[model samples]
Target: MEWYLKVLKNYFGFSGRARRKEYWMFVLISTVISIVLSLVDLGIGTFDEETGSGLLSTIYGLAVLIPTIAVSFRRLHDTNHSAWWLLIVLIPFLGALFLLIVFCFDSKEDNQYGPNPKAIPDDNAEIEA
Candidate 1:
């Protein structure tokens, strides 16, 4: 929850790196909330079968659309990639698969994008032989 809220607090932030945990946690929670709102809209008869979108769901999606994109951009930054790479999503099927792979890659420590969000303390003792 903290991770999700942190992302929301920086709702329009796209200049920093986001840890895998923060990105994934926000996605997980948002998905769960969407599902719940969909059910509510269905009960209220505000769901449209034609478009497969409910009033509540649509409203929620619109509200968070920018934040979602912002997080995705930050996630890409964490991998040391440029935000322009997001255009790959327009390439049809391969685009999403490629992005999935990219987002799953381990964060590159202190890259041009920014510092690694998963950085460990340098003060920790090393396992010297």
Candidate 2:
């Protein structure tokens, strides 16, 4: 999907705002790939019993860690919050819950982060009269 690729293309971009769709799509695609890679590692016997994670999965996770955090930071910006808010996840149970609530809401219109991604027209999309 375009959303998933767009997130990856942005790579370490932590500035601009990202819509909920962009964030969720990236999460979904990453989860699916991780599951498949884990299964492949299991079939090849490269899965680590000690860490309970496969080598391929571990590698993939490391490769995407920056992009994942960048997207989260942008998502928070979309909600009109600073990237510092992500530190809340370090707290007990309440932190993650708060972020979940934050990410669920729609983006604020033209916030300081950037334009509303939801309203931007895709360059590849053809507009017909």
Model 1 TM-score? 0.89
Error of 2 at 96 (Å): 1.1
Clashing pairs in 2: none
List ranges where model 1 is wrong by over 4 Å.
120-129
Please write out the lDDT profile of model 1 over residues 1-129, one tens digit for every residue. Answer: 777788899989999888787788899999999999999999999999999999999999998899889999999999889998888999999999999888888875798876777675322125222
Provide backbone clash counts, one per model: 0, 0
TM-score of 2: 0.92
Error of 1 at 15 (Å): 0.2
Model 1 clash tally, residue pairs: 0
Candidate 1 residue-wise lDDT at 56: 94
User: Once all C-alphas are superposed, what RMSD does model 1 give against the true structure?
Assistant: 5.0
